[model samples]
Target: MTDRRLASVGTAAESRLPSRYLTPMDLVAMFRLPSVETVYQWRRKRTGPRAFRVGRHLRFDPVDVRAWVDAQRKEVAV
Candidate 1:
C-alpha cells in the first residue's frame, strides 16, 4: 500500500495524522507539569485539549493541541 494509504489506516477522521500520537507523559513535558496526573485532571475537568481512547490508552491530536494552546493564549490576552 502507498504511504498515504498507510496514514489513513490509523485515524478514521484525521487521515493525515502522522503515526505519532501524544501520550499524557508528552503533555506533562510540554507543559512542564508536576506529573501525568495533571493531564488526567485536566481531562476530568474538561480544561485541556481534546483526547480520545485507543484501546486502553489515551491519545491526543496534535492539531487540537495547537489549537487549544492558541485558545489559551487568547483567553489570557482578554
Candidate 2:
C-alpha cells in the first residue's frame, strides 16, 4: 500500500539524518575543559577533532567527537 511505502521512506530518512551537533560550550562541558577558548585554540593548532562552520557559528559532529575521544585513550596495566 502507498501508506506502507511512505512509512518506510520516512524511517529511511530518519536513519540518514546526522547525529546531534555540538556547540563550543557543549564541547567544553562534555570534555570538562577550562573554557570554550580552549576549543578555539585546538582548532587553530589543528589538534582537535574536525569541526564545521554552520553560518557564522562553529559546530562539531557528535560521532567525530566520540571517535576523537576514543583515539585519545591509553591503556594502563595494573
Candidate 3:
C-alpha cells in the first residue's frame, strides 16, 4: 500500500506530504517572478530557501520554503 511504502521508505514528515514539492518554476510562480533564472541565482548565491538535488533536478521542501519566507519576514520587519 502507498501508506505503508511511504512510511517505510521516508521520514515521518515526508510520508505526510501529499505529492508536492517546489521546483525552480514553482518558486518563480510562488514569487510571481518573470523567470526561473532568479531561483537558480538564489541557489548559486546560497541566499534562498534550502534545497537539494534529486539527480539532475533541484527540489525545495515546502517546510524549508515556509521557514525561509518566515525568516525573510523577520528580516524585513526589523
Estimate TM-scores for all models: 0.74, 0.68, 0.74
**Which residue window of length 10 is worst by lDDT in model 2?**
69-78
Whole-model lDDT values for every prediction: 0.86, 0.82, 0.85
Tell me how far the alpha carbon of residue 38 in candidate 2 is from the true structure, in angstroms, after superposition: 0.2
lDDT value, residue 47 of candidate 2:
79
Off by over 4 Å in 1: 1-19
**Candidate 3 on 1-78: residue-level lDDT in tens?**
999987777576555433587898888877898889989999999999999999999999988887798899999999
TM-score of predicted model 2?
0.68
Query: Tens digits of per-residue lDDT for model 2 on 1-78?
Result: 999999999778555535689898988887799999999999999878789999999999877876676566632221
What lDDT, from 0 to 1, does candidate 2 have? 0.82
Expressed as tens digits, the lDDT of each residue in 1-78 for candidate 1 is 698887776456454444487999988887899999999999999999999999999999888887798899999999
For model 1, what is the C-alpha lDDT against the true structure? 0.86
